[model samples]
Target: MKALLLAGGLGTRLRPLTENLPKPMALVGNKPWLEHLIVHLKQQGIGDFVLAVKHYADVIKKRLGDGSSLGVRIEYAIEEDLLGTAGAIKNAEDLLSDRFLVVNSDIIHEISIIPLLEFHRNHNGLVTIGLTEVEDPSQYGVVELDMSGRILRFVEKPNKHEAPSRFINAGIYVMEKEALQWIPKHKEVSIERETFPLLIEKNIGVYGKTINGYWMDMGTKNRYRQLHWDLLDGKFTLPLKEKEQGKGIWLGRNTEIGPGVLLVPPVLIGDEVHIGERSVIGPYAVIGDHCELGRHVRCSETIMWDKCKVHDSTQLNNCIFGYGLEVGSRHILHEAVMNRAVGVIQG
Candidate 1:
């Protein structure tokens, strides 16, 4: 079945990281964010994909380019203007199959689609929303269901005391083409706010299937950092075979380590990285491709993107670095996230 990936959302909460980058293009582990999501979905037998993109659409197009590199067939539904959730689906109407799957842009999960498909097929509901339990129901629209699994009502970010159930929208949905009737044309429509509620009010069948798996939404800076930490701690597994190179370190090709360098476990040094002598890296440091570090540099719990250079005696902890940044000698930073180039620094 065809899966529609919502890759166009403007990541307002994840600033700097998403300043020049699309939310879907944010780096997760060593691969592009969307790449990681697609690889996992592809492994679960998703045949084809439709990326509905608006913001930074070209960047996504340039990187994914027909999905051939990822071994899946991909088509783009480029929106000229901002189309909200249901509108995005409406814009891609021609590309969608009779039965399709819709996943939110921020969602990343390991949940299997087989059971959800089976549940959708067996039930009489025209729409099936995959539901997952979350500790904070206040952050997401809560799904309430009848005993038969038919959805009764949806509460939009209800208070914890007033919440009927802890199960919230996992942002994965199974829908029939007929459901498109509720979504009007040439307008900004939210699937969560508009379509599903109308379906329930019309006595149309809308069901919820409780799914279990590792799931997280990268919506903010804190969550993004937590995602990396979780991955490093083995809470979730990356799809690539090269993820676990040796002793919890994921090393890229042609990486050079200077003598007396200490690499702790759970470190990822990308391709062509050069480190000077006596530098201590990791126990959760993620150095992207072509990064250079001078002698006596200490970095732990840090993630630096490609081409970043750390000068001699610099120290970093809990920092996130963007592309092509250069730091002068003897600088120390903690809990910082950046995207622009760095200038001179002193102790």
Candidate 2:
């Protein structure tokens, strides 16, 4: 099957991180977030992919490189202007199949597509939206469904008291080519606000399938950090395989731990990492590839990107260090987000 990956968003909310890289390229488990999505879709029998990209389009193109190595045929639809969700898909109408899957690039979900496809085919709907129950529907596009699983109403970010249901749009949809007609040409059209609502108004078949699995929209820094914590806690599993050095510590290739270094469980240290003597790491720490940690350093609940250097006597908690960052000696960083261009130091 063919799938459309909407990866063009600027990710304004995830600033500093998204400032240098596109939202789809955000790091999750040491891999680009979009890579995880691709792998997940591939597992669900998707062999062809069309990436609709605008921001950092070249970076995405270069990294993915025709997708041949990943065993999929990948194509790109570069948008010249800002096209919203449905508009982007309309921009790639020539590349889409008669029926295709549409997925938002920033979502982290594990819903079974097999069942969703089954539901969509059985209902013969023009579009089928994947819905998941969220604790706060006010932050999402809420959907109300009838007894037959047909969509009855759509509410974008409704107030808590006004929300009719907790099930919100999960950003995954099975769409038929006929649905494209509802979207106009060369304009920013939101599927949630325009297409789906228009279909409902016309009494067209629009269905919602409430999925039972892990689902999250990693659009903010807090949720991004929480994703890593959840991974280490075994809440979800990625496709990558690393050697388990201890009970809950996963080590990559050639990782070196010095004498007297304390490694708590549930830690992930990437390849060629060097940990100095008397240093303590983890309980939810993810040190990326080729990182250098100095003696007497303490790191917990932190994510250090590739090639980061931490000096001696440094302590980090609830922090995120971007690639190649250097921490000076005796520095104590807590609740911080540091990168080459920006730094957020909170107590």
lDDT of each: 0.86, 0.88
Residue pairs with colliding backbones in model 2 are none
lDDT of 2 by residue, 303-340 (tens): 88889999999999999887788899999888887764
TM-score of each: 0.95, 0.96
Candidate 2 lowest-lDDT run of ten: 338-347
Among these predictions, the greatest TM-score belongs to: 2
Instruction: Report RMSD (Å) for each prediction in the order shown.
Output: 2.3, 1.4
Quality of model 2 by C-alpha lDDT: 0.88
Candidate 1 lDDT over residue span 1-347, tens digit each: 79999988999887776777788788777678799888888998886999999988889989999999889999999888887999999999999999999988687677788899999999887999999998889878998889989999999989999998999888899999999988988889998998899999998899999888878888977788788888888888786434466778888888888999999988888888999999999888988888999999999988888889999999999888777888779988878787654332211
TM-score of 1: 0.95
Off by over 4 Å in 1: 241-245, 341-347
